[model samples]
Target: MNSTGRRARILVTVIAGVLLAALATATVLIARRNADPAPGGGADPVAAASPGAGRPGGPGLRVLSNGLLSTVSLADPAGPRTVTEQHCDRAYTAGGTTACLTPAGALSAPRLLVLDEGLRVKRSVSLAGLPNRTRVSPDGRMAGWTLFVGGDSYAGGGFSTRTGILDTRTGEVIGSLEEFAVFRDGKRYRAADINVWGVTFAADSNRFYATVSSGGVRSLAEGDVAARTLRTLADNVECPSLSPDGTRIAFKQAVGADPGKGWRLTVYDLATGRRTESAETRSVDDQAAWLDDRTLAYGLQRGDGTNDVWTVPADGGGEPRVLVQGANSPAVLPAAR
Candidate 1:
């Protein structure tokens, strides 16, 4: 590996550490998904851009190429990659909109960019903290992000997070989900230490699901974007990702309700309230993405900090396989119909 390759690999390593540290053992029931903190934390070395690098909005898998925005055909994920100028710590696309979280830099603060289907920035907002996770609504009207604001790891209960929401249509931005009113068991619930993250919006764009932690309990909370309210639905659900059909949620549940024991990838049936464990039994820590109604995709880090995008049967059958290599964040772009 040359200088750029070495840097990219090292980034892969640091990013893995960032993810692990972001949700290590003995946590505060924190919510958020994945860790793809930029290439160099603050700044990145110049990338060796290749010929034929172009726009990445076609039906494909959009991912970070050592922190550079890149894409690969869903049919041939291991094939040639189309690189873009966008550099982000975390990225996600939904309903023709892309959310890019730039890393907080030494000279420049981190920011969020809302982009159109053409990958053109429609809006950009300055932000604070380490970019942890980001998701756009299915209709592309809403976007949310999570940041590691304080401390390094959750193992010592030393980490904190700030999650925010943005309404692209109205140019409205909620700096933190903490501003919203939370309710549990049909009453207003308030805690001195409340954190919310990993927002997965519903089709209506007005309603969404996210992990809301209060009183050291993480619950899968449903939110009303218009009312700025979140109602607890279930407990011990972190980084909830609502399925495409809206009938199920893919989340990470800590082993034996202990974060130190690591988390197991599980799916919950909304209508039935039954849980199904995914086939990949490793200590998965990132928020999962639904490939369809029956398949799930997420980033998994190796012991050495190398990362890869993996997929498995969401129905709790079959085995897990690497969908893309040398990638941490995986967002599936709708294949051109």
Candidate 2:
């Protein structure tokens, strides 16, 4: 054969091989994409972002599990539509941030995780005891958690609680409320038995309310985040939840005279100093969440060992109504804007 003809045949052979390789690569890519549907297709959109993500108002309810953080539509409330993989024993979401508490692996230390809008962990704080109560401020600037610690005489309510607050933006932690100057009955008192837990933040995020206990007596105290001071408001109150309007506080008040037996859901008006008890006759032991300006929601323990979420009028007029079954630690996730 001539030299030119031989060169042309060689070129054609190489071109054919290149085309076949390209086709094979495309086939493998398609198969791999089909095998992994995480970003699309069979994936849950709410797990990623909801339609409200770009809208002005579409917040939904979120529930926590050992392995999943499930989200349910507020308007629907039937079944969970989306979920993110998490190990939160308890969780609270607000202002586009979700904070959760999960057990530290292979150790007794617990961890509080601050998650972003995509459900990604932004911060992890090592805690000292079993996770009890977790909350975030209305503005989401502050996060707080309670853990069950052992060793105090007044901690006989099963376990003592260690409460801490965090400023997520600044990464600052107020690990102990005991550091604050506590005023009781208009007088400053110092005692070694001071323990604070079940924090509820105000809308401004600078003021908070929590249960302060000493010598086995519990009281509701208002705290100033900036001043770092606490003043007792009333006795026999635990787990205080500030109303949405910030005018009243819904708290668990010791029923009759025995605090250990349980508490009653009561609302105390800050302006009038008036207190009213909810219609729920059962002893509630959990912090209450304000569903609206007039409704307060809390957890009630049942005989089956499971807890249910119930709501009552903030003014203490109507009977308690069950809102969510088999769930506890209620928080009203506001509409996203």
Candidate 3:
């Protein structure tokens, strides 16, 4: 071959090698992108897109404001972002699901909304009375709510409430506790004035705890969702909130005879029937939310007619701390892990 032809062949060989190197580099880059982990762990590209996915469980506090829901980071509460424009009287979030109580209309009944991870309403049910307390089970299978009926008021005492449970998976709703069989002192008691509220479900979806008031006396009672029965555990314990570990419950106990001024925070052990008062002396009438196994969070009304979220030690020892200001009815948004 001539010298010019030999040089042309060498140039073509160099061009082919450069093309191969570029293709190999592009393949490695594509593999690395595909292996990128999601927010929790899997390769679900939509996981990070979900609201409250990357947020911390205990600190990502969402509270109700002017009937709307707002998300505020307890670590930096100065700037709050409103997640939804719709009004929610109260809400509870767990395991990528949120259950909110929204007003349906001026004269119509209220509603219970089961929201998706993106804060969109997936399912809703019409509810009666004003929305007071709402909660979702840890596993996100069941949701419960307490509403003031007839004469109950959220800001004052001397009222009755109707509590209900809903199976999110089956869309089955237990409208009232009146349908459940009640056993007082190991005997079945059927009273017309019986009222129930403040439901806290156990880790197992079959069992739950609530305050059953009959004959003007309130008592802590455990219920079986499958059997529709309740057995009185202890008396004078109202608005019970189960702990994260399912070992104890944080509730409000009347001091003596006056249920209005006597409301105080108390922790009751489920295994052994023992109640301990917390360091807080103020009247905490709201259903407490367990931030973790050791911390209990609740809403405390200020003198200006607004409420703020406060935290106290679940063991009833440490001083109270303000978790978030200008917020009420706190529900912890658990991070996807």
The number of the candidate with the highest TM-score is 1
Candidate 2 lDDT tens digits, 212-313: 988777888999989999999888888888888999988888866467566788999888889999888787777788878898877776887776667788
For candidate 3, which ten residues in a row score worst on lDDT? 37-46
Q: Give the runs in model 1 whose Cα sits over 4 Å from its true position.
A: 1-58, 154-156
The alpha-carbon lDDT assigned to residue 132 of candidate 3 equals 86
The true-versus-predicted C-alpha distance at residue 31 of model 3, in Å, is 51
Compared with the true structure, what per-residue lDDT tens digits does model 3 show for residues 48-98? 234652244535777776666777665665454554554678888876677
For candidate 1, list the clashing residue pairs, or say none. none
**lDDT per residue, candidate 1, 1-337, as tens digits?**
6899999999999999998986774253322212323322432222443212332444677888788778788878888887776778899988878789987654467889776666666788888888888999888899999988986543335578899899988988989888899999999998888888789999998899998886767889999988989999888888999998999999999888777788899999888889999998997889899878999999998778778999999988999999988886787777654
Relative to the unseen true structure, what is the C-alpha lDDT of residue 305 in candidate 1, on a scale of 0 to 100? 78
True lDDT of residue 304, candidate 1: 82
**Position 270, candidate 1: lDDT:** 84
Q: Give Cα distance to truth, residue 53, candidate 2, Å.
A: 9.2
